[model samples]
Target: METLHEIPALRARLADWRDNGLRIGLVPTMGNLHDGHLALVEAARARADRVVATVFVNPLQFGPHEDLDSYPRTLNDDARRLSRCGCHLLFAPSEAAMYPHGRDAHTVVEVPGLSAQLCGASRPGHFRGVTTVVAKLFNLVQPDLAVFGQKDYQQLMLIRRMAADLCMDIEILGLPTVREPDGLAMSSRNGYLTPAERARAPALFRTLQELAAWVAAGTPPAQAERDAAQALSVAGFEPDYLSVRRRADLAPAGPQDTALVVLAAAHLGRARLIDNLELDRIVAEAH
Candidate 1:
């Protein structure tokens, strides 16, 4: 696949594709390619005539103490994987290319209420960075549709909200979270886990799954949330938040809510893993 490192070159190529009446799909990511990321590229390939995969490790989304410097970069390896997955173009820009004016003066985008809870509470300014970079990518790529992984469910929701709120005429699609055989959600950060930690990491997903079962069985949502957090602790994780919320707005689920999700985040050794399970069908089955 063709790789473009500069914005002008990438935009020119996209313009040419648009002129030729080809629908474009975008899959934005930080390198360190894995099966999950390739799945996103494949999803894009299915929906659009041409697919563009971006591999820039966004500094904006990372907090000061976070692993910005150490985050893996495997552009060459990632490009090979993307090409195999049927991606048409790869955009791997430098930090300066993304933030030409320097981060201090760069314009920021925020989604308000959605950005202030869960992961946001732990990483201040994180979503601001996410929204801003994603906005910039949306502008630069200008794809008709973009694909994001549901593993970052909150980010997906926020991006959809941002695109609509800002009047961007692009479809945002969230694919299902890819997982390992043992139930661990596939993540680039999963590499940070040691062998011992890796064995225990699957508990995070298992906890969420059990929590889903409890909620399905008519357990109180608040109690289920607390139980999930406690289960993570018992599994040797430092629980961050385990919540059940309405799938639409991510607000706490109410008695009348039909569609719901169980979301959790926890620290396992050096890696922080986040995962969620949609419980709408489970609740429906219970009824």
Candidate 2:
């Protein structure tokens, strides 16, 4: 229920909690709260004694042509929703607070290979912004655990890798992707969709599902990716990338790869939606 906007104040509160032996959890987000974001708060509440949810719309993660200025900011409503979801604190900082040195002069964090493909390929310097801001949050909150949604599978993977590579002691947990009844992955950007586009949006998830089925049934990975992209085109989406990659490092999937994920991102009307399914899990359930 308490909201702290400045880093020093938030860090002081977290320090007090740590001194009192309370376990802390962090759920980092850009505002425009929805069920999917609340799900992360709920997961944090279950795992830690106190939860801090951050609501700063990071400018670093957005490209020049992307909706940085128009990205939704519903802070008051987001605060009310997080409090109801049992969040203990909300750290909603201004852009200047996040980048005191200005974005151009700010230190950047890049996961190199991981940041060069899929969504990264399409949105240049996107993950650099993500990794840097997340690193800042991780440093500020210093939580025992942090929760992220699997709806952003690439983001989740890179954060985990960054924390490990940088020797951060915090645990990174990825909760399942929350979805609408029709299977469209719940996203803050979903608000950009018009009513007509919304109706056609579930096809993104359905396309990933079909791709998973194909990979599970022994279809060639490259062929399955091409066919899935084609199917999305027919479903009224301009496909970005529909890929099968090793779930571990997101390297392209080879014939013998068992642990794999089907990931897709595409343009639907004014919104870009992304979704993924783990093929290893699907293949296991076939027996």
Q: Number of the top candidate by lDDT? A: 2
What's the residue-level lDDT of 164 in candidate 1?
A: 97
TM-score: which candidate is best?
Answer: 2
lDDT of 2 by residue, 1-287 (tens): 99999988998998899999999999999999999999999999999999999999899999989999999989999999998889999999999999999999999989988998999999999999999999999999898999999989999999999999999999999999999999989999999999999999999998899999988898888999999999999999999999999998899997777999999999998799999999783333434
Off-target runs (Cα >4 Å) in candidate 1 are 281-287
Among residues 3 or more apart in sequence or in different chains, the pairs in candidate 2 whose N, CA or C atoms overlap within 3 Å are: none
RMSD of each candidate relative to the true structure: 2.1, 2.5
Q: Could you tell me the lDDT of residue 267 within candidate 1?
A: 95
Clashing pairs in 1: none
RMSD of candidate 2 to true structure, Å: 2.5
Clashes of 1: 0
